[model samples]
Target: MFFFQGLTMGLAYVAPIGMQNLFVIHSALSHSLRRAIMTAFIVIFFDISLSLSCFYGIGTLLDHVTWLQAVILGVGTLLVLYIAYGMIRDIPAPISLKDQPASLRQTMSKACIVTWMNPQAILDGTMLLGAFRVTLPAAESTPFLTGVLLASGLWFLSLTGFVAAFRHAMTPRILRAINVLCGTVLMLYGLHLGYTFVQFFQI
Candidate 1:
């Protein structure tokens, strides 16, 4: 039951085509298969780290801190809007393998930033995992967390695999359409978050 619960929750959190998913998809389509896999792994690492931090105690602390939440929401709203703007402006061209691609260090840094800076991801960890962790004993937490880790690893691997498989068949027009869709979604979500942030001040 714990395994399945963790798996379901993990899928629920990751199913959205948010910034992390889009970044992973872009990496898979435009880079070497190995590079794409590395990026996915880096994201998974961040997910695990953040989830564990929340499960341990940080989530509870965050819940009590209204100012911190406001700050996070404000910063997240801005960052997401910036990302949305970038996505809309930078149209995808026909992807080509470059002789000199991004270094592993650079790719890893980007993966870390996307995963960590994502406001939605942070909230999900603090609220969801934090709540769930309270329902289990310490011994059970490990197994539940293991299940979560498995789900994260599996999901990213499958995502990268699917994107890599179909990348060659995808035309530039299709890629551009996808970019537009992702940007629109991010913009809408950012607006929604901004509204939610405003609600925090209601007396």
Candidate 2:
């Protein structure tokens, strides 16, 4: 019961279209199947690590530390906006299996940045997973967390698989359009973060 509860909650938590999802979608639409899967695995690694950290206690630190929150919000907003700008400026070509993909190291670094540097992700994880951890039975904590981690793996793999399945249909025009839309969404999110950062000072 606890595991299912966690699984449902985890799916709901990660289902939103955020930077992580955007990265995965871009990978799926552009890269070869193997590369896309690799990207998803890399993202899953960071996401699970983040979830573990939040469940253990980092969330509490962020929750209480106003200065740390401010710093993260400030930096994250800039980083997100910069990434969005790059995505818009450099739209990818249509999918090609023969195309050389980005290095694994580069993919790992990007995955780490998107998952770790995201202030909204950290706060949300802390508020949801970290806070909920306190309510779990000591023994059930492991199972609950297992379910959450599994959700991350499943969702990313499923998303990658779904996009890869339709890779052939992704024309250059379609890919460019997707890039623009994702970039616009990211820009909006960055602006929202900036607004939140300012509001933090007002509070």
Candidate 3:
């Protein structure tokens, strides 16, 4: 029962079109199949790590430390906006199987940044997963967390696979359009974060 519950919640949590999802989608649409898969795995690693930290205690620390939250929000807002600007400025060209891919180190660094530096993700994970953790029976914690982690893995793999399967049909125009749309969404999210930060001070 706990496993299923956790699985459902996990799916709901990750299904939103957020920074992590946008990065995965861009990687799938732009990179080779193998590279895309590797990127997905890298994202999954950071994502799971963040979730674990949130569930364990990082969220509690953030919740109690107003200054820490402010710093994260301030920095995250700038980082997100900068990334969005880059995505918009450097819209990827059409698929070229012969194109050289980015290095694994760069990809891993980006994955880490998108997952770890997003204040919204941290707060949401803390409020949702961390709060839920306190409600679980000690014995059921393992299975429930297992289910949540499994959902994350399955979702990213499935998302990457689906995008890769249809990648051949994606034209340069279409790719550009998607990139612009994602960047716009990211920009809006960054503004929202800025607003939240300002509101935090007002309170």
Q: Name the 10 consecutive residues with the lowest summed lDDT in model 1.
A: 93-102
Candidate 2 segments whose C-alpha is farther than 4 A from its true place: none
Minimum summed lDDT over a 10-residue window in model 2 is located at 91-100
Comparison by TM-score, 1 against 3, better one: 3
What is the overall TM-score of model 2 with all chains considered together? 0.94
lDDT of 1 by residue, 1-203 (tens): 78887888888877777778877887787677878888889888887887787767775666788688788778777777777776667667676665224687877766665666666677777788888888888778877877887888888889999998888788888888877787788788778778878887773
Looking at model 1, residue 144 earns an lDDT score of 82
Runs in model 3 deviating more than 4 A are none
The lDDT for every candidate, in the order shown, is 0.77, 0.88, 0.88
lDDT of 2 at 137: 90
Q: Predictions ranked by lDDT, top down?
A: 3, 2, 1
Per-model tally of clashing residue pairs: 0, 0, 0
What lDDT is reached at residue 42 by model 1? 86
Sort the candidates on TM-score, descending order.
3, 2, 1
Query: In lDDT terms, how accurate is model 1?
Result: 0.77
TM for candidate 1 is 0.85
